[model samples]
Target: MAAAYEELDRDSFAALTLDRLARRSGVHVSTIRRRWRTVEGVVVELLAERSSMLPTPDTGDFRRDLTQLTQAIADFNNALRNRNVLQGLLAAAAHDPRVEEIVRAAFVRRIEEVTLIARQAVERGEIPEDTDPREVIAALAAPLYYRVLILRGSIDERLVHTTVETTYQATVAGVFVRKESREGNRKGDREG
Candidate 1:
């Protein structure tokens, strides 16, 4: 099964049929077809496995946390290496709702993990509690995504640090004011 999936990265699945995968795996075609929901399932599983190998941050600093997140994304893109695989999968996703669902779920899982780290920063007062963790993470990640996927640029450590620092400062400035205003309102309520 693994060998078949590895071969998939080298060639398009459209070119490699179920019979070929079964032959490569030394399993019957019906066996492979029965267990896997879609041919993409094997690929999705490979992606999920790769994602599991990413490092988690425990640095206690928001900037460091953001940097780690950005690095993980860069690492993921680097590991994939084959940009055509991603493009092909995305093209398939446009026509197949199941592929789209899997892709969306995978992305949500990754984003939520980053959000949890930002939430921890809020709890530790590294950032204001009113700061939306999701927004903060998006600010850090969106540019990296745009640079890599849209702009066809690189993901360097310097870019990661700059984006993380900028997002952290901007998020603190925006959210801290809201926190102060809310506190003031509470104090006024108590006095009244």
Candidate 2:
């Protein structure tokens, strides 16, 4: 299937049929059909595989831990074929919202893995208990997205340092605290 995908890089998924993937993978067409209901399913699984390239590691250093994760993301986007595949996915997504949603959701789900860091930070009192994991995780990834997708800039050591530092500082400043929690804190202060 990967061979077929490499061959069909510039071509549409319609070019990838069960027979074609079977020939490329040397797997039986019936098995392929049973495992993957459609070409879209095969693509989704491939995207999932790519998305999971970054793992959530706990090095006992909160800032360093997230920096490593973001660095992995940067490296993945830096690969030429991966970038091309992403652009192709985006083009396909323009006409197919389902594909867009699936890919987006898969990436988001992967991002959620970093939420463990946030949780650990809260437990260690490194950050406020009300800090939202989703916000912190989003902050960690947004700069990488901007660098790779929007600005087309390169991700270097400085960018990685700044990204981690900025998120860490923001978290400490309560920038990621939930709105309701902030409101309640204000009320508590007034009462006190």
Candidate 3:
């Protein structure tokens, strides 16, 4: 069943109808129809498994944490290159609402994992407590997604590292400025 799903993923199940999948898997059309839910299930499982392999940082430094996180993402992209299964899912997601749901779930899981890492940084005092974990994760993710999906550019280690560093600095600076402004406002009110 796993092998059959893998084949379907590489060939893009979107391009293959249920009858075609049954023919390719040497199963009956009714079997394919009955197992349709399993196909999405298997893909989601695979995505979760891959996401679980992402590195978590205990370095107690925001820079090192960001570097490690970016490197993990780079490694993930490299690993995904050999797995044609994801490409098939991407193609299917273009047209199938069920596949899209699975894809979205996978993405949410990835973001949640990143958020946990960022929250750890907050606990360690590497970032301000007011910083939203979701924003930190998004900062790291947005550029990579844009380059990969929009520009169709390579997601290399250097690019990932640079994006993380740049975003971290900018975000931290913005936080500092906001904090200073709030302090100034409080002081002004006290004087008045």
Candidate 2 residue pairs that clash: none
Candidate 3 similarity to native, TM-score: 0.69
Arrange candidates by lDDT, highest first: which order? Answer: 2, 1, 3
TM-score of each: 0.76, 0.78, 0.69
lDDT for position 105 in model 3: 80
Q: Residue-wise lDDT of candidate 1 within 1-192, one digit each (tens)? A: 476556666776566566777878888888877877566766666566666567667698877877777887776664433343454566668889998888778767877776777778879987765666667777777887787668777777787778877887887776533444445554432212
Candidate 2, 1-192: lDDT as tens digits: 475557465455545577777877888888888987756667777777877766886887777777788788788777655665565567667878987998789878876777898888888888887788888999988998788778877678888889989999999899988876777745443212
Model 3 superposed RMSD (Cα): 6.0
lDDT of 3 by residue, 48-128 (tens): 676776767667777777778877776665443323455556766887888888888887777877777667876877666
Distance from true position, residue 25, model 3, in Å? 9.2
Measured by lDDT, the strongest candidate is 2
RMSD of 1: 5.0
TM-score of 2: 0.78
| Alpha carbon lDDT of each predicted model | 0.68, 0.76, 0.64
Would you give me the overall lDDT of model 3? 0.64
